[model samples]
Target: MILLRNLVFALFFGIGSVVIVGLAPVSALFGQRAMIRHATAWTRFHHQLVRWVLGIRVAVEGERPSGPALYAAKHQAMWETLELQMRLDGAAMVLKRELADIPVWGWAALRYGAIPVDREASAAALRQMIKDARRARAQGRSVLIFPEGTRVAPGETPPLKPGFAGLYGALDMPCVPVATDSGRCWPRKGLKRPGVITLRYGAAVPPGLPRRDAEALIHAGINALERRA
Candidate 1:
């Protein structure tokens, strides 16, 4: 079932994204913002369609931060990245430097204003990311990050690197921790499975906490998921 859906998605998204990207010039020539918006619309459509076709239901747990907050999520599947784009409008994601190497998808991400970061040189990169994130917040765009840094299977916890705390410490933004069992459905290395994926939003850690304290808060957030479940 998952293979069938993936084949269908490949047939559509592969052709569709190329054609959608080709629409860029229409806006460029016409001097309109429609090109970028159209691409986002297509991506949003792809996200919704995947959920529908693969029988994966997404459930949200917990509240959205009242103000612009840094979103730290568990990395699981590609769907998580795609759905995060649609889940929050104008949201900027902190993706790997590698993703920027992709052809059409990378260009589309740049067009949509997604922020890519170098996970390897994360310490030095944090400053620039802070600037980009703040700019996005000023533009009413949320910044979502995958704190775990890499995709891991569900029913397992990956040791998180200190990137989240390092970034948050410098910027001192309100950081929101979200836990999701998305690996159960759209796992990192398997065909899609039919199941409900839970996204549990936890408290927004206050700003100005020391780096160590901030790190603990984010770690505790994931631990909370285990306790609550």
Candidate 2:
């Protein structure tokens, strides 16, 4: 039954992507704001699908930040990626260069202000990412990134990737760390289960701390839920 539900959800998700990408040019014509709205709508659709079809409920704790800031979130499953966009009202997402290179979808993502990082390029990519992130901030959008760089299992907590610190120092914005238990319900490579996925927003770490301090704070913050579990 879970398999069937997942299949149905995937089908609709694909259709939704095609429809949104197909309309990207129209949204782009109006400008970036319109494109962002279009992307937000797509994320909202994912929320709806999760609720009605997958029987999963998302519970968010603590207040979402209102102003432009950097959101460093736990990377457990793909679920939070879509949810963060909806929750942040289309904050600029930091994603892989390959994902941002995908044909029409990539074009739409760029229009929606996604910052793509070439993980293998190290220093050069970090510079480019910071530049793109600042551009997004100037546009009044928060930047969302998974500091760990890849999804982990429910109980695993990995050290954040080095680029996170570089971006944090360069952006000089309040870093809001988010914790989640989505991996328990939504596995990285398996049928998603029906359960509650909680997202807990931690206190914002102030800008300009030493790299060690910032990384320590964010690492603990984003792993809060896991620690409790």
Which lDDT tens digits does candidate 1 get at residues 103-128? Answer: 86676566666677886755668767
**Stretches > 4 Å off in candidate 2:** none
Best by lDDT: 2
Per-residue CA lDDT of model 2 for 1-229, tens digit only, reads 9999899999999998889789999999999999989988888999999999899998889876678899999989999999999998788999999998899989889988999998695788999999999999888889999999989998899999988998899888999999999999999888998999999999999999999999999999999998767
Q: Stretches of candidate 1 above 4 Å error?
A: 24-36, 223-229
* TM-score against truth, every candidate: 0.85, 0.97
Clashing pairs in 2: none
Where does candidate 2 have its weakest 10-residue lDDT segment? 58-67
Error of 2 at 208 (Å): 1.4
Of candidate 1, the 10-residue stretch with the lowest lDDT total is: 27-36
